[model samples]
Target chain A: MPELKTKLKEYRAIFDMKQGELAELVGVRRETIIRLEKGQYVPSLKLAMDIAAVFGTTVEELFSFE
Target chain B: MKKKNNYRNFHIITIIVVTVVMLLYFIGNIFPDNKWLTPVIIFVYLSSTTKLIGPYEKKDELTKINLGRANGITLITVIAALFVISLIGSNSDNKDIFASEVYIFTALAAILMRSLLFIVFDRTPESLGGDE
Candidate 1:
């Protein structure tokens, strides 16, 4: 199944955030940001919600399937 | 369901095979020349495989599946490696067993396979056999 990930770069651009800053915001390892951007892992529901909340968006808006 | 303890079978068969293998080695006077290592290789592989995988099988479900997968991968990798070595050695009159890829392959495969199995098993305090 193709998993559409959050446009992390876009989110970071809105927040004026660097990878390290975003990782800190999300309370995850910096490497996790790298993998998330690459679509290597589907973030857990809790993590998705957390990331979406950080960006002031719903998890549904942040993630989608093509 | 009563968890089966087939550990006894594992122990008995491995011990018997080891003893027989050792006896055969002693009887044959295995030396530097004209001494095929197939029997010895099989003996060590079987015994180690049993010892490493058996206890986990008795204890956990995931452990069994992981070990089987690791073993399957290792067996495939080893066969591939052996075939490669044979291919390379086909032209050479003198193949140095000491520098053979099989040794490195076996060591890497066994260590990774067992470590993956152990990680998958994810030992608990109870599994550690602590004082009850």
Candidate 2:
């Protein structure tokens, strides 16, 4: 599978949210968010949607196929 | 943080309990008169690993994944040990090839099976809906 580059950190910073808070909003552990930010883990479609919703953007805007 | 600490404590306690049970199981093997002890030990070992216990039964997806990985690793370790035993059996003219150890493999495989099922079913839509 192609790697997904996430703009999670950028959006998170724009929203001034902590990793744990974002994780809580997205219904996942903080480590999941941390790994996602580091590009070490891929989010499922539902999780991706949840995260994108938290940042008030679409999944395509938050993540890029690379 | 508090929840994480509790999980750590639970794991520590579980390790101690499992260690004690394993030690007692081996000790029971040396005493043929106490045949009941071994079965009880095996029961506890199987139940704990299979997540029959409350804390483990309530594990999250990440914890379930870790448990599955642990089961896979432990199954590999058990298989390696069995191979070594078989080699010893060959060298020592024991044609049985450590037949008794098959019980251990069966137990380990059962745990691995349970872990695999947990990993698979935990991600299902039903389980997610049930969580809510």
Candidate 3:
């Protein structure tokens, strides 16, 4: 299976954001943010876009398949 | 997150309560009458289905995915168990294995499996990867 590597944690850190805050902004559960950061989950396009938008980045820049 | 946790807790509590009630009924110590067994069994089945199919707008995509996976696994497990029980009933002289009590037991087991599996899926990581 393709692994979905993410820079979600780094982005959150840079933004000084909490997982719960990011989740709220993206309209998801905090656990979902944790999973994405751990690369344990692959977000949908809409979620990816939302998260990227929150961090002022593009989805391609936030996530990559390995 | 709090809302999701509450929803999860509600499901776990409901399943546990129903399972305990069904077990007590099966033991025949608390309730000697079988009049309420059918209604209780039906309630369990309906509640389980509702939990699986009800509105999940409060849940995220990952949670929704996990829920689907859990329900799928529970359905297969229950079907396999019933098949085995039916086989046993057909080949053995003890046809009482196909009794209403057994159905109730199966329903309880299915819901319990679904709830546990959902928790497991929700907590476990999905695949091998790391934050970059």
- Give the lDDT of residue A6 in candidate 3: 91
List model 1 lDDT by residue over B67-101, tens digit each: 56657776786778667777777767767743644
Instruction: Quote each prediction's TM-score.
Output: 0.37, 0.55, 0.79
lDDT of 2 by residue, B43-102 (tens): 776666445543432343455566667667667866786677777877997577667645
- Best prediction by TM-score: 3
Tens-place lDDT per residue, model 3, B1-132, is 323343466456657766776677768766678678657766875676456445333678998898899999999999999999999999999889989889978887887888888887877343422222
Evaluated at residue A2, the lDDT of candidate 2 is 86
Measured with DockQ on alpha carbons, how good is candidate 3? 0.36
Clashing pairs in 3: none
Better of 2 and 3 by TM-score: 3
The TM-score measured for candidate 3 stands at: 0.79
Mark the 10 consecutive residues where model 3 chain B has the least summed lDDT: B123-132
lDDT of 1 at A63: 77
Please provide, for model 3 over A1-66, each residue's C-alpha lDDT reduced to its tens digit, 9 standing for 90 to 100.
889999887888899888878888999877788788888788999999999999999999999999
Candidate 2 chain B lDDT trough over 10 residues, lowest sum: B123-132
Clash statistics: count for each candidate: 0, 0, 0
